[model samples]
Target: MPPPRQSIAHLAERQFGVVTTGQLLTLGVEPSWIKRQVRHGPWNRLHRGVLVVHSGPVEWRTHAQAALLHAGRGAVLSHRAAGYQHGFLDSPPRVVDVSVPHARHVAGSPGVVLHRRRHLGAEGWAHLVNRLPTTCRPDTVLDLLTLARSDDDVISLLCAAVRARTLPAEIRDAVMRSPRMAHRRLVLEILEDVEGGAESALERRYRRDVERRHRLPRAQRQVQHRLGDGRRVRADAVYDGLGVRVELDGEVAHPGGRTDQDTWRDNAVLLERGDVTLRYRWRHVRVTPCSTAAQVVAALRSRGWRGTPRPCSADCPVT
Candidate 1:
């Protein structure tokens, strides 16, 4: 009989390196066969005893895959890693994070980030379609909220999560049940603050903490309000009560193709309204929504509107 086919060729069909000894045993390949294959350069050792066949470049599986291999039987992928796996983050994270039982610290490998917590309650873990483990939406959000430093960071993340719809209503409700009820409330407030009000990123940020928080008179967003020159200009937001027209100047909005004409048209609108327009960029709108809102509120007050500066804080009463 032909010398048993080279062990290296046999395992390559699966397309991932990093296999356990038990897997080899199940392949009906004897222990002596494995040793002989290793000694004869038919396989390459990746981790301690974790073997890779020698026919191709060493393949790097996802960190989740590596973690599952390391944790062996009990661990599940979770936290930021699971978020990435579940399409929570707008972009993939640079690191691999995994969650294993508190029973013991699993051995580490290069680029494998392990998080050990006793809180892997049943809801925290889920199988990723028979692949590496992952965390459900609620647990992932909870993990992020627990670790993030500022309310702003949490809000930013929450906006993206809600937009992605990875955070279902049930997951959001579960967050309220956690010990951080106050923070959870704040997150929900932030989520409500941003949803469906504005179309662009900059406009959403402004509408959430600035327009709504300050109780500035409402504006017709993306509406075509015409100027005397018969030029029709669609302002980002137009508050007729304050005669204050707010425009979120973004590259995408005024992409240089027709922005100059649009700006000239906007100037026409301002002149018709007797110079009562306030234009803002992303930086001013995002960093200091309160201050930006204050400016807009003051301008609105000038136009015979009455209001006080309303704190955007969750505890603040309606002004």
Candidate 2:
């Protein structure tokens, strides 16, 4: 029989000190040796057959490794767990998410969510990230899309995932792959806007809720202006000839001294052309869109814009 160090110990080192009873048996380990380790206090049982080699604290990675072991062959980290793994999500999920083949049955345990998917494998849909199986970048993004609670969540999720790793085309292809996915059309629409320069969710909301819904004058997107220093800058939304520019700020708008750079561009527009700029954040654009539309209308009118702001609906706050 092979020694424990040569077989089970090596696997544990690679898998965050986690090993399965099935794996240990395959490596020629006796059954009582596993039970004795658990009973002796050097090891702990995390699930039916999954064991952690150390008695120390169990971290997130260790929990994830244990969950995968319990799930057995052809199971992968998916949904929120995969999103965290792919860098698409901002934080780690409290519950570990795993997907197993629909035909394969695995009983669930506490703190682990098992997703039974029709086509589950390490094929194109999944990838090995840091020795753990996770859904591919695009598939992870898609899974989060279906799981989003609101339209804003969908937009934020798409923008975040797109900026983090996967290309816009990859997202679209994943959409095509899942024909009957929940919120498929909504995802496709948001994907289109993201590809068309709606880089942030706040910007997309401004276009849909404040501008289009209120019937505000069409604003050209990403209009370029050459500064006196010969450098070029692009404004988010511009009303050409009227000299009105609108800027949209998401939660993390100005980072790494971008505020100073933005001020310089605003000064350039104000000094060179005597134009006015309006800036809005998530609250102005998302929470109170009609009020935001009114403010935008007043700014455009002050700039000699003749068009009148139209109320989006009968109950719209805009007059």
Candidate 3:
């Protein structure tokens, strides 16, 4: 067998250069030796019982490992931390979120958020990422929605996941089946809208604030059309009977240059077919929905829509 020092080094390498005092003791290293190494050697203390083998610049994974070690047994990375680990988040987690069994009494630390779960060890609740235990992607998304501060944040996260094709169908089903989850009703409603083809937060806002709120006729979302050159194109929203199309120009949907050209080409094709297309940007849809509704109403009326536009509320300007 290799020496105890070699064994410890190998273990630390596997764990993002983090090792616990208990792990060192289990490797047959003397307590005095471990203390001396931490005090005088390259090892740096991260938590009460956890030490990083390197004193140099630490990576994001090192922070995760240290938080997991400090959280003790039966704990898994969760929430934003799990989102980051699973590539759902654009940036590294600011604070580590760890879920421990309800029976365990792990206290909260400076850089760690502790969540107690009654059935954390149940099958399918947790999985491994880079050798570290973490909540499943679906659970992480739900947890994030619960922890979200505003409806816009929740919608943004859901839209990001959907745009990246990382939001699985099972996650939506799970949320629907879970009746006791916090914000369950709101999440289910959003999931229903998403399933109905609101692929981005901007599209969802248009559907809600501009269409439903103003009492405008419902338009088909993501309607595909065949161009003169036989190229297939999907319009953001289409009113078939009225021959009117509403396009939400979200940044993710119409990334500049090539996509812009494609959008212009699609608009020309629709216009040639006697369709009226109204294109709106993020600011137009989100910041000024009343004005957007007015424009859509005018387009729909010109295309023979007889339904009168009504204000969403007494204060709404759509009327």
TM-scores for every predicted model: 0.63, 0.85, 0.83
Which runs of model 3 end up more than 4 angstroms from their true locations? 1-5, 30-33, 160-169, 176-178, 241-243, 251-277, 302-304, 313-319
Best by TM-score: 2
Q: lDDT per prediction?
A: 0.65, 0.85, 0.83
Better of 2 and 3 by TM-score: 2
User: 1-319, model 3: which lDDT tens digit per residue?
Assistant: 3338878879999999999999988887788888888889999988889999988998888989899999998999999999888876878987899999998998667778899999799898898988889998788888888878877777877766665565648677768767787777777678777878878788888988898889999999999878777877678899988988877777755656236676675567666677877888888888889889988998888888899888876777776
Supply candidate 1's per-residue lDDT for 70: 64
Clashes of each: 0, 0, 0
Candidate 2 per-residue lDDT over residues 1-319, each given as its tens digit: 5356666778998999999888888888899888888998599999999999999998888899889989988889999999888877777899999999999999999889999998776468887887898888988887887788888888888988888867989989889988998788888999988888888888888888888898888888877878777888888899888888998867665543248777887888899878788878877887899998998888888878887677978988766
Model 1: which residue pairs collide? none
- Please list the Cα RMSD from the true structure of every candidate, rounded to 1 decimal place: 7.0, 3.1, 3.3
Q: Pick out the ten consecutive residues of candidate 3 with the lowest summed lDDT.
A: 252-261
What does candidate 1 score on TM? 0.63
What residue pairs are clashing in model 2? none
- Give Cα distance to truth, residue 54, candidate 1, Å: 7.3
- Model 3 residue 103 lDDT score: 89
Q: State which candidate, 1 or 3, has the greater TM-score.
A: 3
Regarding lDDT, does 1 or 3 come out ahead?
Answer: 3
